[model samples]
Target chain A: MTHAVSNGLLASDLVKNFGSVSVLKNINFSMNADEAVGIVGPNGAGKTTLLSALAGAFQLDQGSILLNNQDVTEKCASARCNLGVVRTHQIPKPFDGMTVFENVLVAASYGVDADKQTAYQHTLNAIQLSGMEHVANRQAESLGLLDRKRLELARALATQPKILLLDEIAGGLTEAESVQLVDTIKELRRQGIGIIWIEHIVHVLLQVAERLICMDSGEIIADGEPQAVLSNPQVVKAYLGGGIE
Target chain B: MSQWTNSVTIQRWTPSSRYAIVFAGLVLVLLALAPLFASNGLLDRLTALFIYVILAAMWNALAGYGGLISVGQQAFFGLGAYFTIRIADLGLDPFISVALAALIVGVISYPISLVMLRLKGGEFAIGMWVVASILHLMVNLDGLIQGETGISLVSLNHYDSAQRLTIIYLLTLGSMAGLLALLFFVLRSKTGSAIQAIRDNEEAATSVGVKPEKTKQLLFVIAAFGIGVAGALWLTSATTFLPKTYFSVQWSAYMIFMVLVGGIGKFEGAILGAIIFFLVETWFSSTGVWYLVSLGAIAIAFSLFLPKGIWGELERRFNWHFLPVGYQVVEKNKINTDKK
Candidate 1:
């Protein structure tokens, strides 16, 4: 096992299995603060599962997760969120009954444990950052696809996370919408929040990702600079079989 | 050059909510002053209405906001009455026993909630009924209760009928008001948001740092406490301690009916539904089985036509919020940049 960084995220020998199938096998990953890393993989490559593990959605069957050198493998999802590890769902899951502002406020209030005034401020700022200020008072269930996706991002942002795990937040959007999401992610990178983004859209990932990791059959096949990893023979064959357009 | 900036303000009250506050104050004043002028019969009916309100509000907070959808709250209600009787037997004033009994129910419900709250959806609903049945059987085993023969709070015979009527009325009214106010403030607080968030989507709520189990447990315990008080208050009025009467599934049915008819999730809807149910029972209860049949029919109709409930429809159409338990973000200014 490599030494855990005191100011970043680290995972070593991570193993997760579902019944007899090993969804994630011996996964070793690490990222520094403010580093923007993108992950691309074929279907069933365990990208989402990896994000879920890091976010503490469920306990790992093996290995460990370290957030800022704090062993967080045993912590629950909410505790990890409070510890500054937050994630957005691949499929947007807003609190349908709550307004956009209220949805974000939940994260600010509980995720960061901000007081009322500070939570309100953070909620407003997150809404503004996600370009959702216009519909801040609108019911979350009433949002269109793009707005819903933005809401997912805004909610995660309100957590004031040290490390953000984004799972295909830009999926199923038009090219223009994708570009807009990329711009927001770029801004987040500028603010020095460590990000591990998983997206199938190779071009969008290249826009904000300085480093890239490619996975095949639940194993990291290539890890390095975005262009280098994308062009790796194993990655091209496993993920981008038709080659990047 | 002039520059514009947007300032966001968080406010809970709108014009409708302000009007609602004034209206609620007026109603409370009238209810408080009722015993002075109201007849014993009128006071008796009003007390029943208060109990119904308590039951509806408690169930609404549990199933509507917390998403527990328990069908066994009667367990606490029955326990409350039984404990009140037991405490009175131990030399405490029965009136004081009511409060003490409800507190005991709250304490015991924590452990119960830990076990029962693990069951979800239909399992939770039926599991609660089973728990109620178990408690009912346990109470039956007590020699003092005398099984189906039942027991009565004979200690209350010391008060004259008029005095008993007035005291019970005041007690029930005061409790109903206090519980409503408590619900209002709780729904407005951050904890209120946590429970509602859990109801919306438990997994999503957890990812945002809201502990679903802990939040649900708190709500469950509170609902049990309030329902227990309602049960004890009901016993005070009836002056009877029939386990069959207090622990019946009918109480849970009534709660479900009121909450569903009024609007399942809306705070005002529960109150409105309780009032409607109370009025319906007062008018049509003489019709025998048809009255219950009609209630079932109304609940089904409401479920089919207005799943959000009557209050939910009204809110959607007229944009009225009698109890604004959520935040509204007001954009103070809009910035416009002309061609540079």
Candidate 2:
């Protein structure tokens, strides 16, 4: 049950461009250990692209990322994961042929180099944490949308990450389910895991995140206390005509 | 302590006992008495069936369990045969030659996987074919195998045809059982889960910290090793290693047909497919190229109509599997403590 405190993450002057189109421009951000931050933006605000860069899923066109006081800008995704950085996808990508238990089992074994018995117990804990124990024996492909999201969370959590990057986990969930997920995230925060949640469900973010940042055109428009950030004039302008009020 | 002990005992037998029993029974029967029926042509055909079983199972492990569809296994098979011939010329026993040849082929295949693993989907499949063609041409150019004339295995000259055939058959059976057992152990391990995860979804697997490229490369090498052993055993029985026969595209085609017809992922499906394939070959061998045509037709039919293959269909219907690779925790004897 012991959790390591991450030395926090720092991204300086981050920039990414796909062909002639600039997706992220001169982005600077930092999140401390035990901090829960929520990222909100429009559909094409490059929220996912930023998450991918932080997770080292792809190389950044320019900028440096430091995790725990070490430069990890050139590290691969697996190397970042081994350094206790993990991220889930906006779209759940559960292994189709694997059962829920097996999916988590792989994470526990390879993510931290735990022995078989310990890995098995960790896998069980992850399944229990995700509230997916009932479907552990079922193939992941057979799961519904909510269960797929749960499986995605379970797989990420089983890696025993110090920093958990959640991308739109509550995006497509029902109101009740989003509330339940918010509770889970709150519990994880209580356990001292740093979480960066990218969510379209503003209410869920409001419930769990102490800090909130709004992005427009891939640049942070507002950053502060959740209430203050949500109420900022620039944030209001970005979500204009989208009914933020 | 009593509760802990009880749970441990239950865990011991819960998941894998039935499969272990079934696999043990099959191996015992095959090893103990299969040679007793050696008088008929049955042993000869069964030997071939065993070789196909190994080949098909190796392919299944690559594509089904590991999600790597390779059409270049014939390259290793041909290398194994040619190496066996070379080893025999150096005065080695045929059995030792098979092992030596397998080793050499395994080493050669490691570098090959690096190049082949870069291609994905249809590109990967065609890349395998291209590798096979290159290897075929290279082996053909080597005059030691007499190009198309084929090389007669010199070491088997002492044994009569039937004796040699029997020994070769036993060797193949033993190799098949060993390889199957190795695969069963691998599939039961955490590595197997990672491989299965990669097969299901590579991006998900990477998210979970499974290195897909490393896993695929290891599986590629292991599969090549198994195919190489099968090749050496095949040449020993035939007492000849013709570059044309050894390096033919037909070897790859036959393996694909076997796995596709029987079942791709299931271990026993490979055995079942191999037996069915050899039986069909026996019946249709007299039809010349029509045999290949018929095989192709059957493969197409299975691909279109029964995409999961024959054993897969049967498994779905009956919920039966001889080699079960995954574990399940069963809740037994749940006590209502509060009611009690």
lDDT string for model 2 (B1-340, tens) is 1232233211223223465567677866766476666564777777888899899989989888888887778888988998898887788987788899999999998998898898897788778878877887888887777778888888787877777777877888888888988887888788888889988888767766889888888899889999999899898878788877877788888888988999887776777888899889888889998888999999999989998799899777865554767755334453211110
What TM-score between 0 and 1 does chain B of candidate 1 receive? 0.95
Q: Write the per-residue lDDT of candidate 2 for residues A6-83, one digit (tens) a residue.
A: 588888889999999888998988988678889998878888999999988888999988898889999888888888
Minimal lDDT window, size 10, model 1 chain B:
B331-340
Task: Identify the candidate with maximal lDDT.
Answer: 1
lDDT of 1 by residue, A1-245 (tens): 24467788899999999999898899999888778889999999999999999999998899998888889999999999999999999999989988998898988899996789989888888888898977987999899999999998999999998889999998899999998999998889888988999998888888988889988788888898988887788988995575654
Clashing pairs for predicted structure model 1, backbone only: none
Off by over 4 Å in 2: A1-6, A241-245, B1-23, B26-33, B332-340
